[model samples]
Target chain A: MSEMLWGIVFLLIALLVGFFITSPLLIIISPLVEWSALMPYTNRSKMTWLIFFLSVLYLLIFIGLVSLFQSNFNGMFSKELALIFLSIIVVEFIAVRTTQKSLYQLYEQNKWPQE
Target chain B: MNKDLVKIILVTAGAVLFNLVFWNEKLAINTVLFDAFLLCALFFLYPNARKSAAVNWLLLGHLVSLSMVVIHNTDLSKIAFVITLLLVAGFAEYIHRSAWFASGSMLMNVVMIVASFAESFKINKSKPANRKGIGRFIRFAIFPLILVIIFFLIYRGANNAFSDIANRIGAQLEIFFSHFFDFFSWQRLVFLLLGLLITGSILLKSKLDYFSTRETRMNDGLQRSRKPMRQKRNGAFFSFVEMIMGKMASGMMALKNENTTGIISLVLLNVLLLIVNGIDVDFLWLHFQYKPGLPVYIMVHEGTELLIVSIVLAMAILLFFFKGNLNFYKRNKWLKYGAYAWILQNAMLVSSVFLRDYYYILKHGLAYKRIGVLFFLLMVLIGLVTVFLKIWSRKTNYFLFRVNAWAGIVVLVLATTIHWDEFIAGYNLKRRNTVELDVPFLLSLSDKALPLLDTNIVALQKRENDTRVINVNDGQPACDTCFIEQLKQREKQFEQRQKEYTWLSWNYADAYTKQYFRKRGLITSIH
Candidate 1:
């Protein structure tokens, strides 16, 4: 029971970190993600629950990946790999920033629907 | 804007806070993965050409290709990554504008999009009810915090059992409280305020009152003017506005004048450029061995700087010459041709610079600066082409700006994808003439240098040994022994490249090098 409790604590901690870093980016892109995920499903309730389930899945996958990284090299770092990782983040940031700005402008100028 | 978006925002914000509080670290794959997932989510968020959110097959394919390059992360795959990214940018431009071969206005679109994030927030004065609610929240939180502290103090003073219970909860609470409280530190507080501002702006993203509001204001103005213009409220302010407007009008009139001073200046400048280009081709290219003994450093460095500045000045001049009356400046054919000739000469100069750089690369092996110079020259060439296109098509400045922006983005993304250290190391090592090879520079590269260097280890080892066997009979160290010292310096570079095997920082290239070195018994197996 204690072990299970600690596991839950660890899981919660991991989820929190993953969410904060991912939130601004997700919030920027939320309208599109909302549209894409909501399009195929007709019921709002069902879609919301489905989206919630997906977030959980995303959280679990993130934890697993972090675990794999931890177990791989025992904690030393490679400059090249760090560079590769940083590049991905930089590219991603620019992409999302640009796209969201476009979406915001469209919605504001054209009254493109808040829903 | 929907409740679902609110929920997603809430959850994502919670995650960011969690990372900051619990999992913040300098080197983290978790951070990388979270970022990747968010980026993948961006594909769905992207607005289509028709101002709709739609996910097509091609978009998905592009996303998958990039994700693969990011995840699989090998040398060859990075090449594919760069090409695909450029293609993605071009495709996005095409779809957004509904035009192939996008012009320069697209660059403005990019700037507007990047700038739009500032519009994502808003701040409104807090109403009494909202303040009351905030007060209530603080009261609830502080009261509980006080009770917990007081109860804990009592429990410790009361008995062993109670004290044990309080201590356990206190231990856990300390972790939570410290992490939470850390958010109030000066730096973190500043970030939190910034985030609040951004989030508020996003939450308050104005439904662009731009067009509709303007229309209403215009109608109101017409209605007000129908009643007869009101007496000027402030004559001085009106006079100031009028004076500014007059200056702008006069500036335009001056620009349109036939005796525009710049025309004579341009004539002299064009003649000077012709003379310079004449000298460049005649000597710098045809009979150029400008500095044979010196390293190709000066040519690649100084020459690239000179050529770029020349092209930029040429652009500023071209833009100036084409402005106002000169657009159709009655019978300035010689001037137009002169400008074209100057631009054409700039293009040739870029090529000549490239040739010199290539010659340097061939002789001295590749360096980061050389590679960067190559990319810069590519931009210069692109700028020159845009200038030519601008003149030929009589396109707007927006077209020039847009194409150049796209060219720059493509070049940058392409350049980033290359594994330069490995490429340079391999290229230099492959050069047949060892005498021409920059052995010392090659030795200084990362583990990526090893696979190629492995072949020449025997020669390097011999030279390393010969450095110590210097002859003192001539009382001079500057003989065959100097070459041995050069080789020794190359060997000494190995000391800097110690293999580190931590999952948090492991690079495949480094691991490969470590294993290879271990097999050769040059380094210990940390694994």
Candidate 2:
């Protein structure tokens, strides 16, 4: 049981370290998130609306996660801990990669304005 | 890969590093390094900023900041540290890139960043569709992963035997998590983000597309009112304000129809001020006899405040009378002289105020209010001088303002150098301290004054002992215990206060005084 728990701990630490290392990119891409979300189509006002919705949704998700985890949990690696850690890592990776691809496509589009 | 990225990275590093301020004070060195980093960031952001004396001034500011951290605390170092902040703003303005203040650079950078928000955001949509596989994999894995964790926790909670196994896991987890929890509470994380925002706001550049030239303009009335005031065409809010103010502006317009009323009022105001000054001269100075029972402190206190307000009013009156056509049009020469006569009399009134406050300070004891009155007098003197210069030079009111602002900057640089705690302690603890030595007040002074207090420690201890004996003999045995308890309480208070004074607040006066006392074996070395 001890060995199994240590294995899980190591994995979680690795996941956090990964997020920490890439946080700079995430900070830079955060303000540009609306572009990626609305890239498949083009409408300035609609993108603004989507940005607002995304922010609200993120706030709700964050609040919900905090409420669930901050309460008493009876295990070393409870469902609350696992979900919070995993969700954070997933969000970081997704945001970073999505923003990177979106920005690169933007550069390409700027290069070929005729399109 | 890009210049923008390089600049952004440097700024981000500075932002992130600044948040570690609470972790350890020795990391103040990081603040200096980050300031240097900011210059480079600014260079990239404002490519047009050329080499000038201002750059040297900026470098001097950086060196001053560095010395403030490294050098022994001294009398002047505290002031120099504050001046460094002003110089940084001065540096920005000197390069003609921003106003000679932080708000200008802060606002400019914020606007620059926000302007590119949409353009930067477009990058998010630019991703090729082929990445759908990776996206699909993430979406596919996340939901069940969450569900599995929930199920696992619920299963463990249901069985009593599961806790025995979990305790073993708890031991494994605690070791890894302790270090994490030690440094990061939710509060610290919030401060960390705030640190980032401040850093980015100060250093980030949205664009470097233009060079700022001196002629481009400053956001002040002097520059705007110079080239023939134009009609408002920008927006409704401004036009509305203009429409309302149009009548008032015409009242003080360059061309005037009602000069007699303005001129007659100026003459009467000057006569009234002269009477006030003559009476002050007679009673406060000439033919003055001390009344043993009369309260003189109120004269100094109330009189200083009243005199300052009077001087300010005197200047405003001059400005109102001499404004626009009254200044340039030749018919109001007598009115201008009356204004000058009133100004000179007001100057004398200021002098009387200074004398009264100074006497009060010397007779009583040095305190913050005494120093504050002195500073107020200095400002009033500057205002009076500016008014005289405006009248004699026949310069625009805007020009007068521009000059006064610079004067204020110089005064500000001078103001920050003072170590008030030490000054007050030393002044009060002088020979005059024997008569009315407020031991409680002396003790309230900062640790920087500890050395001064230590020099007079024998006298102070004797005083405290005498007070305790007197109180105890007056049928108050509790005073004996209270004195000892007070000493213990004060010692605890000093120790608590000592913890907060670190490199961030390191100064030369404190260092010198601390060293003086430590050498004499009065106390332990100042931390």
Candidate 3:
């Protein structure tokens, strides 16, 4: 019911749709996490687990797809294209997930002593 | 029904179009078709944007420039198409908000597009009533979907036996999935992202209205500020200038002295230009002759370059003199007259440049630089006219820039409407008897001229033979059959490349060449 729960829910949806349907859809989690960070009841532990699961989910799917289709790929250019796709995916994962984690850590580090 | 839903559909459709049309091909009709789609999307999304006549003109310009890509597709036309795209997007977004300048609007369009991605992260304070429905869908539907995918992938990768079993169960779906993922290659993915960005940039208006608010405060007309000039903190140079002027440095007297200086400078410059123009009229205009081996390298190239630089310098001088309070001076009539005479003389100088280029073109036939000189001269003429308008109406420097920028864009776009390679080939081949047909130059033209060259192979061979004899007499070694061999090689290469192009990369000139080759049985009719 809270904003935090909604954010977690969208993150899960983003991870699912991104791995199954399209990788670009994974970008939705960025804004969701950003919005959730502003909420009062945000739980970093649950958010971390979801983010971890998201990356692992993508890696497994990527491995499965490559194993199935790598031989079917036609040329050196196709393999290079797949590598580029993987590189971009890795960059996106780092850019969105790692940046959010650092922001949460930064928030905790900068908290007042009394709080 | 929802605007966001419509936006998503438009983005998906645009990405699909991008993937299908531009997945590794040269720009041609496909670019024009894509632009038309963007324009249609713009109109549907921003219906009121058409009410702005400026927006309508920009859209037309965008379409015209984009159409040039289909017609000939030069570097100039491609650049113009890109610039016009930004102008159209910027104007459509801020049509009613500001008196949009081309450069500023383009910059704002880029900024807002990039900023919108970040702006999406902001929390929407206004809550919709259907939030509970979305929440229910996510909790029930998304939660299960995510779990199924995670377990499916984990089990599939962790155990090959399970993977084989899963593969058997999903063999039909695997084929479909593989077929679908084939579309997600890196280049196509990049294209899809580009499509999303372009669609989002034009369709999603950012909250940052920096240019709009700033341009709203600006006016085209310059008002005479009666306020005293801000006194500079005296550097050594300022004090030295003030000391040199004595009593004339500080007030109305300074304006009078400046006006006198401007009038005297313009008078001297006008006299000098008159002498130059007189010489040009005598040598380049009336008494022009194409002497074989007549140092044309110096006559046309150096002469035209010098004259253009002088004309540009003359404009700079006029802008300098009429920059500020000099226009409001009571004794500025003589200065204004001097400027008018100078502008008239500069116009004559531009004509002289045109004549020089024309004579060169007549003698040597068409080339890129000669055509470039014509367009550059046209832009200079337009710039001169805009400078005159600025002085007459007390307009700001921005007005001059705005008008001239549009003129430059229109000229560049119009320049690409004709295939220059074909024109050059036809012109040279037609005048092979009178004009010095530079066989090597013709060979260097793009493959668009293949049809013309093939038809006039005999004329080209004759010219090459004449050149070879001259080279032999000059004690240089020259090959007899090398020219024809090179021509044949070029023809074969063009044929091979043309046969490979699909409908997505079609161009009029290229298609014409293909048809020509096919008619002669050089290429088969299958493609």
Give the best candidate by lDDT. Answer: 3
Over 4 Å off, model 1: A1-115, B1-36, B43-263, B290-293, B432-440, B461-527
* Candidate 3 regions with alpha-carbon error over 4 angstroms: A1-115, B96-100, B118-184, B231-247, B289-294, B473-478, B522-527
**TM-score preference between candidates 1 and 3, better one:** 3
iRMSD (Å) of candidate 2? Answer: 10.4
Summarize candidate 3's per-residue lDDT along A1-115 as a digit string, tens digits: 2443556678789879868877565586655455434322223432443444455456566666766887553453464545655666665544544355366664465443433
Cα lDDT tens digits, model 1, A55-90, are 444545444665687865533233333334445545
Model 2 DockQ class: incorrect
* Per-residue lDDT over B1-527 for candidate 3, one digit per residue giving the tens place of the 0 to 100 score: 76656666776687788778877777888897777788888778778888888787877777887877777766667887887777777777774333345356556444444344333343354653354355455446656987797667667776789888988979976576557557656566767868777766666665545567677766678877754445432556446757876667666677788787788899999899899989988987788886776756567787678777887788888887887777777878888888888888888988988887888888778888988888888888898898889888888776787777778667766776777788888888888777767778888888778777777776567666677777677776666655567777887888677667788888776777777777865422111
TM-score of each: 0.52, 0.63, 0.71
Tens-place lDDT per residue, model 2, B1-527, is 66546655665576666665434443234445555666666666655543655555545654654564444343344445534543453354334423233334445544343233333344446554556667666767778997787556655666668866877898877766655545546445656656655555555533322233332443323221332345424546435635755654334453444355566777887788788778888876776554677655787877787786787678676776665445666676777777778778888888788777766665667777878888788888888888888777665565566566556555644554455777887888785444456667777766667667666655566666677776766765443233234434554565555476665644454456546644764232221
Chain A TM-score, each candidate: 0.31, 0.30, 0.33
By lDDT, the better pick of 2 and 3 is: 3
Q: Which ten residues in a row have the lowest lDDT in candidate 3 chain B?
A: B114-123
For model 2 the TM-score comes to 0.63
Which residue pairs in model 2 clash with each other? A36-B124, A36-B125, A102-B123, A103-B123, B73-B507, B73-B508, B74-B508, B74-B509, B79-B417
